[model samples]
Target: MKLVVLGAAESGVGAAILAQKEGYEVFVSDMGSIKPRYKAMLDAHHIAWEEGHHTEANILSADEVVKSPGIPETAPMVAKLIAQGTPILSEIEFAGRYTDARMICITGSNGKTTTTSLIYHIMRKAGIDAGLAGNIGHSLALQVAEAPHSTYVIELSSFQLDNMYKFRANVAVLLNITPDHLDRYDFKMQNYVDAKMRILQNQTADDTFVYWKEDEHVPNELPKYSDPSAKCGFTDEAQPGSAGYAANGTFVVNAPVHFEMPLSQLSLPGRHNLRNSLAAAIACLAAGVSPEVVRQGLSDFPGVEHRLEKAGTVNGIHFVNDSKATNVDACYCALESMTTPVVLILGGKDKGNDYAEIMPFVKQKCRALVYMGADNSKLHANFDATGLPTADTHSMRECMEHAVALAQPGDTVLLSPCCASFDLFKNMEDRGEQFKAWVKQYGEAK
Candidate 1:
């Protein structure tokens, strides 16, 4: 069969490689310049690929297409393919077709990376032959092509879930749903919610759906499910019949075998992380992993980078890199986790964020605010009347300088932008790495 892959980055290149390995006629195309390493791979493998432009004729000849999650459905090329009645599959869907691995897929607006990593940690601790894929580690298609494991802990995004149809998760984890990435969803909450619900699409009675019980959008959506038995719900607050809950600094999961651990033992902090812990633990237990393994994984997991990761402490001021906090909700979690007064770095490509959601936390916890992005007018306007000292800058260096000036001995300098990083940095990881680098170079120098 002719297989065409779009956006020749990690996932797309991986899919092309897997398709070629499976004896399919493969062609890869990217509208932007393909990275040198990826171009080399295509050349070495003798697979056909093109960069900086899409040849419509070549792409149109495919029997199937694998699309990278980064591409929006609204792209002219994609829309043209849709008009031609050609089916498009996400990298996860294309990769899933070739593997018999038990899929443990995790998705949410936030906390997904942490939960996915934690689950992967627990599965390995249990001596399970597992591979980390999806949004976190290597591309699933690449892993399936080279060394496929018996199980996979996949960190899925709503974009990845959108094009997935027949791919079923043995264990599906829905962390929470909030207003995020609405621009891609036509500025509709229901559309974004529908995209997230696709994770449950191919699930069956034997499959487990572990989700956050307290999420505002989840309960309303749960009624559509015909079977409640498949659900393993969790909450940070007490919910008597929930599969997991946190109380008195302890996280308790009542499934497979009852287990409990003090919240103090959890490597990640904040109430949001407590909720992430519950979802990961319940999913692990449902996968037949012992409670002991879950406990060990929860305790030993250092934490995922860019999600409230501690950069360093200098002159009694703590620096935190939460560059992954790309939405109002994520920033709320970061703010809530702060024990000391915060010199918050906020602003980026605003995703129609409602800053009102975080205003309460900001009023209570924020010592000063530094706005950094291609545009900072919205933030300055919204925060000006709050009477909390605020400064605006366009670069990460200026952001740190303002933060350093505002920070005191017991202050925390946090880079939780609450918006997309594309305005200033390549992505969240790039933003986070720069934050850490600057903190180490400049902040620690003092």
Candidate 2:
């Protein structure tokens, strides 16, 4: 069958490779430049690909299309495909059809990366043959094509879940659903919620669906998408019918296997992490990992980068890089975990964000605020009333200067910009790296 792949990045390139391996005629098209590394992969496979433009004639003739999660349905090419009644599948969906691996999928607006990594770490420690894929690791399609594992621990985003129809997760984890990516969903909360609920699609009684029991949205949507028999829930406090819970300063997992560990033993800190730990432990246990292994994994698993990562200390001031906090809810978690007074950095491409969600934390925990973005008007309008010391900066250098000036010796300068970094940087990782670099340079000069 003729298979066309759109957006020649990780997911798109990986999908093209897998489709070629499956003996389908594969073509990759990107409206933007393909990275040199990806170009080489396509060349090595002798696959036909075009960069910087898409040929409609070539794309229109395809029997099926694998679209990058980054591309929205609003894109002209995608809309054309829809208009033509062509099947467009995500890389995750296409890869799922080729692999018999037991899928352990994790999704949420926050903590999904940490939970996905933690689950992978635990599965590896327990000597289970597993591959890390989806949002955090190598593309699932690439892994399925190159090195298929007996099991796969995937960190899924709502974008990846949107096009997935027949993919089934043997163990599914929904961390939490909050107001995020509303722009892609026409600024509708239920539309975003419905996309997240897609992770539970194709799940059966034999499949396990693990989720945050306390999420404001998940409980209301659970009955609409999944069976009660497949439900496994984790929460901060023990409740009736909970699969995992925390009590008396210990994390507990009941189903799949009885397990408990002191909350203090968890490597990742904060109340949010306690819930993350609960979810990971439950997922690992449900996958048949031993209780002892899960405990050790939880205690030793390293935290995710750019999510509450410490950049460095400069002149007795600490800097944290939480660039992954592109939404208000994530920034709320970062602020909630801060013990030191924070000179909070906030601003970027606004995603129709409601700063009110984090207003309480900002008023309580922040000593000062730094607005860094192409536009800081929204931030100012929301926070200027707080009357805390504030600075407006369009660049990272200026942001660092203002942040350092506002911070005292013991204060923490956190780069948890509660918005997308595209206004000033390539992506969140670039924003975080630049923040760390500035912190390192400042420390050296001091």
What TM-score do all the candidates reach, one by one?
A: 0.97, 0.98
lDDT of 1 by residue, 318-349 (tens): 99999999999999999988899999999999
Candidate models: Cα lDDT each: 0.90, 0.92
Question: Which runs in model 1 stand beyond 4 Å of their true positions?
Answer: 227-229
In candidate 2 the C-alpha lDDT for residue 407 amounts to: 96
- What are the per-residue Cα lDDT tens digits for candidate 2 across 280-385? 9888888889899999999999899999999999788999999999998999999999999999999999888999988999989999999999999999899999
The TM-score, computed over Cα atoms with residue i paired to residue i, of candidate 1 is 0.97
Give the root-mean-square deviation of each candidate in angstroms. 1.4, 1.1
Error of 1 at 425 (Å): 0.9
